[model samples]
Target: MANVSRQPICTLEPKMQNTIVIGVIIRSQNSKIIELARDRFNAGTRAVWNFTLRDSFNDFINATVWGTVEYVNKLFTTFTIGSVVEVINAKVTERKINDPNEVYVPSVTSPFTLTLNQHSSLIQMHNSPNTARYLKFLNMPTKDPGGATNLNHILNNSETLKNEYVDVLVAVTFVSQTREIVTRMGEMTKIREFEVGDDTTDQTVSLTLWESEWIRLADKWEPKQTILFLADVQVVFNEKAKKSILTIVRKTIITENPMLKETEELRFQFQRKPDIRSTSLYAVPNPNSITKQMMIIEITSRLNNASVLPSNDRMQLLVVVRAMVDDMNLDCDDPTLISYRCAKCKRLVSDEKESCMNLECPFGSGIKSPINITSINVLVNLKDDTGYLVGCRLRDAAAEEAFSCSADIMRSEFKIVSSTYTT
Candidate 1:
């Protein structure tokens, strides 16, 4: 913390292009950069040590402070994470180029690159305000996961799911014996995966642990230690297995902060259940708020129906599926269920249906009523405090509300052209 002698702090924003900003270093990746780039920047390595600074408005920027053998050795030497400092004449650079092939967002790792050179001034703040006071001054939104979904909910509610990290309360069921694997880059990395889940689901998702000098997350687990895997657990849908699995890459955070009551509850309530939910932390929802209202209703998260299984709630609700859209391509997974119908009668038919085949029906006589998508459905697995429920179907109006698209559009690649294109 730094003492500025009551000097006012300058708030940093994307709107301010080339300006010096003073803020607290709430996040730092100096060590990660050093480790990952150790081989690349081995001797006389000139690399940038990245750090994120938060201003009074809770606005944070990831700044890459360049380090060299002559000028600056490395970042975090004078200030660590949560240290306050005044950066003189910081310039915001363009976003780094990303692979266009990826359907996922560019990643939080890609932000307006903030760089500071040797000529720039770095003044550390010693008597900075406490977190309480800083928060008050920042006026940032309170961090709250009001409607976090469990594994059951995740498997069930597809609309509410986004590309960002998820929160789960999982109990590690099985830890595979450690193994060494080679990455695509020909780097030999030791890796291991384990199954974790809550009591609300059928199976557990996999969480991978890479080999590190100090078994970071693995060591954190005691004979049976439970903690919140706060964010960074990547949700990957295995198309072959037809289920979503979690990937704990290097960015994952495993912590048991007693201050977080939900995490404590998760820690204490964890049982050796085959299918359980893990309490993870996801700070925000997808920012996409676009929705359409009609006879259909959309619901997100879980309905908390753990007391029973194979349930259906007609509660038509509207919630932001939150595409988590950035200025990039949105994370749109293939819809779980597609609806098909007899083209002539508009009656529901299987996707493989060639004709109506009804002996008494006119369309069944000889007409080839190729099944067209009429409506799509989604299955929701929900959990309440009482118990867990699985295989709850969302159809008709509910699917329309949640997916923000008609059943026809959801089932096919064609969009609604116009009123003239109506079937």
Candidate 2:
């Protein structure tokens, strides 16, 4: 590749041919290959890779490559994130603000998008002393943190901000495993859910990564270690759960482990663990976030308050209760010991059904085989000198651990072992 004169991103114009631009790859999504129907009987496959490039001046633009699967895949794999690459002979096009697809593009200072064609555009690894200037863009946020919304404010006023977009600066608190599922369009995709929190509040909020690029990047993120500045993230409402959720739409731009002063402040806050009780059954890594011991009467009172209070208004807390099992079915062979629920809608479904039964669910209607998650839904009644807690459900890993049995255990042997313990 010739060291052609590099052009600044701010000066790029539509229809500009034989253009050379040099920048660092701040963000890049995994290349996607899809089958395209050209005619009634003919079909072909095409691959596209999308990434964001930022110049030393902090001016960034969205770039896309469209070509055969082999060409796009090679380009995507060859140029990893943070690589300073030089683009030659690429075409620049004016961005159509009114285009629906434009919403998916990252918000950049530039008003144009770069298009790299297989036959014309060439990408070469840039190696020069000037590369240091572009490296700083890797950790710089596109937006200022002064105007970003706090996680506390977003959660408190979620109803008012429904369907709106907001900027946030948060640190990763937890990362969940990725799950693969088929969408309503019959396309298979993967999603991973993770939780983040900021100094504004002790409450942590869960966010999901739908794109393969973000998902892959999140795999390396460490809990309480990685700080992020998210721009233009959509606030969506899940009616079934009766709460607001932050979703990573196409307009969302995530800056991982930003190097801003505000991010350092946030990191300092994480270094000093908060004094909060864990409200989860799973073991928390932090010893400071331990569960409190509560009497049965206190537990019942808290449950009553939670039942009447709005979901958004409810306070989160974790506690340990000391009580004797008043009622339980130790017979593991009982069919009621295990239950299935539609993963998408959280609705109960028969074990024999292949799809969710809730017609309103996206995976419900016309879905021949909806995805479902199995749970060990065993109900146990506990009693203490103060009061009795009835129908307390023990599910998932907790249930398996309590009974010393797993889902794969033989029914007869599980029943015999379960009978040994008197509840």
Candidate 3:
């Protein structure tokens, strides 16, 4: 009689352990599949196949098997592009596009597949003669038998269960409204939180920041810049919203800062563009007394004519110019050129001219005749940020004044600092 000793089953490494059971119905299977038959010289011919699983968030590897040629032929006779199947002994392999000899298998492999038989084997393997037996003894259906249904249940009841492992989130368009702060976690430790808006639902979410992330964030962030997190943060749903508006409770954590470098580079590039209009307007308030707020304008073109007026007059003169206007003054001390349509002839004219030059106009012959009239000159007296030119009429005089003033101011304010001495 031969004596036999019980042998220990080979356990998969933690990283390689296949938690997915065979015969499990995958809620979804997305993969690229290819099937080909091999012509073996001495050995029996075998079928070779490949598949790549794909979904919204991830793409994974899957293997296909029909067992033998007869089985494959019968199974794949009506196989379509999206036909689902269970897989077994599915190993992750890397096949070179250019060279077949370069094929290699990944260190890890998953035995789980959509095939029912494979899924059952997986569940049995995990439960039989293992610590997970308790889970099987509880009569809980094996993952292979009911994994998809269980997953769906978990997802549907995700709100009530408060599963911290998974979350869903949508981005807020108004980035300026979001706030950020740092909080202490333990002794000599801290974490960052990004507060985001959900005004439509009248709520907010916090994105937690881990260590090392703070350094990168601190390196380049401003008070009110619009940005997209690009799924780099997780969203924690708020139970309060669920009670009132059927919302989920969650918080955001900085998973990966893919946009940090791009954002910082973009900001620097924007700042380097030399805001000609705003720079010109910097002299408006007494340079000594001007606050940071007083010198900045929302529009980019306003800096074109900042220096034409004397310092005192510059402070008093408020010019709310439109983007379409241009300053044509020869001296640095004139206003900007405003353009308008002639009231009598409907001809395009500069604000400096009172009457339309069109000979076809019936009223062009009279001075102060509404047709022969001089350009209107309304004292602009404008406030730094309080005014906007929405529907106002323009005159030829205003155009000329704007041009002259802008030109003179630009010349005086933008004098190039000379670095060379004349010989």
Candidate 4:
């Protein structure tokens, strides 16, 4: 848990403020002294200063000053990169350098641009332990980052999209052919575009698979055909397209039909922890019985003791929800969230559309398997004595045991809201 602080989270905005701006100076550039005269009376040099400042929310803004010679130079000296400071009475102005048609968003998480007045005081607490106050807030467990994130979570979250690189699990919805395009330097290159989404989300993310090896993966991909592991992919929210965009780079790993059951289960556990108080909790296995028995634990957080965990094979963690994730998005109102997938193929199937997409599926396409055999993956959070992990997805036999009933009855009886924070 993070300590509470009354100090306001100061995000750089396009407005003048009389109060002080509190954040860390992430970057700084020295002001050049341009001399116009040799005489002592008015021979002083003019200086301009520019820098970036960030707050606890990871919001960043460019702060600059163009003023009388020594005034701007003084600010340049006081506010160095990585220095925490409180600037009293700052001015804000967007950089004219960026094109007006292009969005003003930073290529990174930064917010806007600002300028400090000559009279503004810079209170830099370099030696003090509170200097890195924002670091604590950043590390606070508001949410998990750095792991494979779903397209649904990315589309709904701006913070995750701001990440420089993210791993996403999505299925191919659309795929385009490789085409030649000239770069700004007039060099010819090949590129392809595709779309992908998951059951949790309605929107499809646009994927621009860049050449040279990535374009070859297109041959292996077909519409609604493959589950992909997109690693180290950069997400850019395209305003005009009204969807998140990503480009395949050399670092990106695009794996086809990867087995992600453990990954999916881990994510579900983290997202929504199982409720201990539910009447349906009868099926939950005894914590003591599973103590010596190991379940396959595939995912872990920093809080867990990795030394005891397995490296060669999957480890097991018998955990219950200490806290429940906000599941407003997956409540009774969204019937889709409570739906099911085929019994044999495990592909999603609707009452109206029961036929499986797989032609060679064991049950075969258009077989119309009964709805009772289908399944739905519910998201949850889980914790053991040592620590906790979020987004453990419970489904099938696991779901039945955790909920103390058939998957059908569990959906109708399971509570979306949780009251175990005190637990």
Candidate 5:
């Protein structure tokens, strides 16, 4: 076979300075590769290998060799677990941990092109009978006690699953909220909305369970029960709603399918432990200065009387009421307002109020009459640490100013929002 050079993949330099091509060969005696596996069989296996390299501030990284299957067999028969080998297309990654001393680690799973250009070596090593036997053992298929196989397999084999109408069956595994039954009708009673990627996606599609499905889920399902599968959903444009609405028709099945069944057996699979330390905090800055405004208020009461407000008004209100941002409404006819600073109030009453408390301010009041001003709402953008290339919110004037300035100037001028302390 003719040797074809793959497109060069770039990776961050170990010290987080520059991006080097994957196949770029560097000479470094200080760098060492360690095969940190439980057994010899585990060595060179697809797993995270932590190691340190010289000239790098962060010493730890996961080094994954892409062509390991062939390279492992042909390379020295018994190379030391921690031997120095010049990597071709290795990637650098930061180690996430509480310990400050931990170094940035590279992912062992990253694709890489080997430094050695010998294609014959790879083919010979990969074709070895021993390597074949090892792979056979590792990927051995397992059967359930009831003779049930993966439902995904059945779906994959069927043309219906591959149809454009059939978007991927996103197996949403989450902790059930209430006691509910898994009825034959495949309905969930009192079930909450099934969220994809935490209730929203850039793609705009959202999954919605019908009333009957919710009821069946709530009545028959138990809290912390995993393995609930929602399938056969349809995507609607819902242009008026401004978001894609995913509808699962009555024909949709809520089954203890193979994926869900496996998850059910593993009780803790649904639980997610978020990294609180690194998670970004939502904040609004005080207009007077660059300090972030803070408010801490407890819920006084909650109301659920649907008839109290007109259906049209209720629907309009619901559009703006986000679960995380909105306050609970009191039962009284004149509901007590949970106050937060309106941008206008915050700008005007710097001495009187630390943040906006006025409900009449144009920015605070939801009603728009004839103002040409753009709507004021918090906007989020993705970015990394070190302050360089931080995403900016279009509405944030301060962010716009910072973005226009040089990286060094921006870092010194704009204070990164931290949740530990608030103004």
Candidate 6:
């Protein structure tokens, strides 16, 4: 590592050359191969990778790498998030702020963007003693969460906010499995759905993930554990659903688990509330507000709306269902009748396991003993005139209330009942 003249991101200017810069990669996007048309019948492919880097002084800027598919993709895959990277000879270009294409770029505090090419610019990991300071910037939100639009206001004034960009701070409630669908052009694309809620509202909002980079990053998001500060999310009105929905466009930049006063307050708010589904937060829902009774078909239609999961715990749809229980295994002598979950992290633990395996949990390390709680875990099916609802979880307090017995008592009675039935 030869000593080179380095400049902070704040002082970088357009057309500046021969100056090296170093920063931490706060965010990165997946590399994409763009098809370039050379002639009527000839075509070429180029790769592009975009990422954001932040300096120790908190100045942040967006950077892009462009070259052949192999060249750009290799650089993108080599650097890890939050790692310090040094760039040499990268072209500093003035950003086209008013251009229509700017809408697709992440909102950054910098006035210029850095363009790194395979021919001249070089990017590599730079080890430094100040690496800890740069990594701390990862937890800093790009925008203040306190200034974000309240969730209740968004819900109430959805129509007014349609197509408007807004900032939000929310907790992850549910992350859906990724799915692939064919677009109008017959191109296959990946998408993942997320439900997020905040202290201001009982309702949960949908945030869809379109890029493969984001979808892959979402794998580590745990419901009720992960917090997100999303900047420049577009609020679009869905005519069919007759509601305004928040969408993560290319312009949206997200900060995970932000270290701020507001973040601690929100976490405390969630801790004080009883663990209930998406219908309400901070307190149990009023029985009067849950009067929207729907048949199984209508309920299924709403769940399939691509906005949320029906049973998502962050915000639940509290509804009165007048249906018959088609199937239940209350008296079955099954070893899986009871569920063990870590008290600290709320993640399921196997019966043989003594602790939560989630490394993020406080007790996940073997040095500490994990506290596990046991609860009744059973699935039931309900049928109505319209359709059938299958695989509904009847667990925890709801399970005990429905069966009129504690999980331990139910287990004892289940074995006796099973033996009697067999005899």
If ranked by TM-score, best first, what sequence of candidates would result? 2, 6, 1, 4, 5, 3
Count of clashing residue pairs in every prediction: 36, 0, 57, 25, 29, 6
Name the candidate, 1 or 3, with the larger TM-score value.
1
- Quantify how close model 1 is to the true structure by its C-alpha RMSD in Å: 21.7
Superposition error at 125 for model 4 (Å): 59
lDDT of each: 0.47, 0.76, 0.30, 0.51, 0.29, 0.76
- The candidates, ranked best first by lDDT, are 2, 6, 4, 1, 3, 5
Each candidate: RMSD: 21.7, 7.8, 26.6, 24.5, 23.4, 15.7
**Candidate 5 Cα errors over 4 Å, as ranges:** 1-164, 167-192, 196-205, 219-225, 238-245, 257-269, 273-423
lDDT against true structure, model 1: 0.47
**Residues 224-298 of candidate 5: C-alpha lDDT, one tens digit per residue:** 332344434444445455433555553233333233334444335323421111011112211221122221211
* Shift of residue 172 alpha carbon in model 3, Å: 6.6
Q: For each candidate, what TM-score against the reference? A: 0.42, 0.67, 0.21, 0.28, 0.22, 0.64
Model 2 stretches with alpha carbons more than 4 Å out: 1-3, 34-43, 274-367, 370-423
Best by lDDT: 2
lDDT of 6 by residue, 114-153 (tens): 9998888899888878777788888887876667997788
Q: How far is 156's C-alpha from truth in model 1 (Å)?
A: 5.0
Q: Over all chains combined, what TM-score does candidate 6 have?
A: 0.64
* lDDT score, candidate 5: 0.29
Model 4, residue 388: displacement in angstroms?
64
Full-model lDDT, candidate 4 = 0.51
**Model 3 ranges with Cα > 4 A deviation:** 1-161, 164-186, 198-200, 214-423
- The parts of candidate 6 lying over 4 Å away from their true place are 1-3, 39-43, 272-423
Backbone collision tally, model 1 = 36
